[model samples]
Target: LEVRQCLNHMTDIFDLIDAGVSPGRFDLAREKLKKKFGEDAAILRMLEGDARWIELWIAVANTVKHPKKTERIVVNDLRLLPDRRIQLPTWQLFHSTRCLDAPQALLESADIVIQNLLGLFENLFVVVIDQVLPALPSGLQWVLDDIPEAERDPKCPQRYLLSIGMRNARHA
Candidate 1:
């Protein structure tokens, strides 16, 4: 029941956010989306962390609703193009999406909020892994380490912070 209400609220909020996004008002849209997704995720976790139906339905619904886009950012294969047509790397694209260019004030506030959030979770991941290690099998023992580094679990908050800055570096 709680999960249902949360999902319905998230759906409505996302709709309003989509309607709000545009070239001129992208910052506003991003702020709203960031807040909505952050709160919604935490609430969703609390409400339905054990619901198999919600899990299956969300996975199916994600696939149906957001058809994946295979974006290719390759440099011009045509030999006629200039250097300005240079391929924009994924990291660059990710950084550019941030509101850093908006203003200095916005950037400072963002830094403060991010720092505070980090402080709230300081080293808790280490504790979680330590607690789980004894209960896990030797074969599956790598789950703790692999989990911290592997493909971001969509439902995880740590995965959310795996930035584009570290993404390519990690692969390299």
Candidate 2:
């Protein structure tokens, strides 16, 4: 598709998502989108690549796992969409995970966290679908599903970002 068409398509999808549609329905819509725009991951990674969703995912996960260490890690500095400082959590997470100073490495670690979270999300949905969906009031599912996190898809957009652009760009 042309750039304009791509933009238009993305615009429409965001519009639906902003309308608070169910994730199942949104996931279905994305499938339909992929049929035309190639695989979902390609487009998803493009939109998601380098987005603030990474830091947010890291923030939420770190917060939940280590609430007592909240003061040590603050996610307030990353107003940028594609936050490069994903390693902030490792330092603040209260775990002995090796420091990830390289921004690209930090981004990849963030993706790992996101992938783990997605597993949690799918499992949570499976359990909730039968028990809660039937019992909850109308329109509650879509509004509560939380797509703010959906912006991150278990993979970094720029996992191989040239954090240290080479002195030997092409020495071979």
Candidate 3:
């Protein structure tokens, strides 16, 4: 659920940039991104590539929020471990216990989805910042300085910083 929220927040920031608003609370960033960039955009393409996991996460979040209207898609069964303590399989995002003929593959798939989502966010943020930077006021430009070192990649120092600073301020 937290992961989903993080993704949604990132989407919102992307939308805020697209709209050229001063980065306040706004709604429907994900929808805005899709509408503005279209499905063919690279960032959108990356997200579509992991659509299965995103769909499952949405279903799981809905089930959690409105259990009466949605069914839980993931479950774990407890088992006795060799150490005499009980253990449970990783929580999975599908209704079944197994996927692709393997037990607990759903968790792995979900992890991949999360990783993809993070990458997509990074890519989308870069794209949006590039589009919006020219129009931003000079005083507001200092916000770029807050970008973390990791994202300030030497190969693309100017491109990767915008998203990281905005993310740190919001998520910190």
Candidate 4:
């Protein structure tokens, strides 16, 4: 459920960026983006590249909706530790395991999935911003100028901050 919610949140961000191109529903907006930007568009490419992550997210979401389907999905992606904690393939959630006990592993797994999805969203936002910024009105060009030199890169944390700020400003 939380994983699905996170994906929805990221989609909302994409919908916002796509509003100028297609003002209606998010599905239509995404289609418009694909039509306008072509198959090689950064957003489309990023999403296509994250197929495995999306599959896992969907499987988990389905399991949440239908508990009986849980067995079909690999809910044990993380290994439980002897200390009543859980560890991902690469990292261990020491504090979370200690605090939440048995459920902490599942929570941490959801978090990892959410973070991966957010990373894709961040990359897509950078691409969309790069494509849109230059076409903005001269007065609005100040927005990009206001971004710090370090945050200029799309992958930088500051870039995501700037993107969200711009998104909020547009909505307001």
Q: Largest lDDT belongs to which candidate?
A: 4
Q: Count the backbone clashes (under 3 Å) in each candidate.
A: 0, 4, 0, 0
Q: Which of 3 and 4 is ahead in lDDT?
A: 4
Candidate closer to the true structure by lDDT (higher is better), 1 or 2 = 2
**Residue lDDT tens for model 1, 1-172:** 2323333333333242242333223234335545655545432343233233334333333433544443211222323337556332211111211212222333443355444334323332332233333443333323223235367565653532311222223332
- Candidate 3 on 1-172: residue-level lDDT in tens? 7656765565565544554222321234434557887767765565556556555555566566756422444556777879998664655433332222234544565677666666656666665656666554433332443456667667654433332333225433
Where is the poorest 10-residue window by lDDT in model 3?
Answer: 20-29
lDDT of 4 at 78: 61
Task: Candidate 1: list runs displaced more than 4 Å.
Answer: 1-107, 119-122, 145-157, 160-172
| TM-score of each predicted structure versus truth | 0.21, 0.23, 0.52, 0.51
1 against 4, candidate with superior TM-score? 4
| TM-score (C-alpha, index-matched) for candidate 3 | 0.52
Write one digit per residue (lDDT tens) for candidate 2, span 82-145: 6653333222233233223323334555566556444433433333333333333432332223
Model 2 per-residue lDDT at 82: 68
C-alpha lDDT values of all predictions: 0.34, 0.37, 0.53, 0.54
Location of the lowest summed lDDT over 10 successive residues in candidate 1: 90-99
lDDT ranking, high to low: 4, 3, 2, 1
Better of 1 and 2 by TM-score: 2
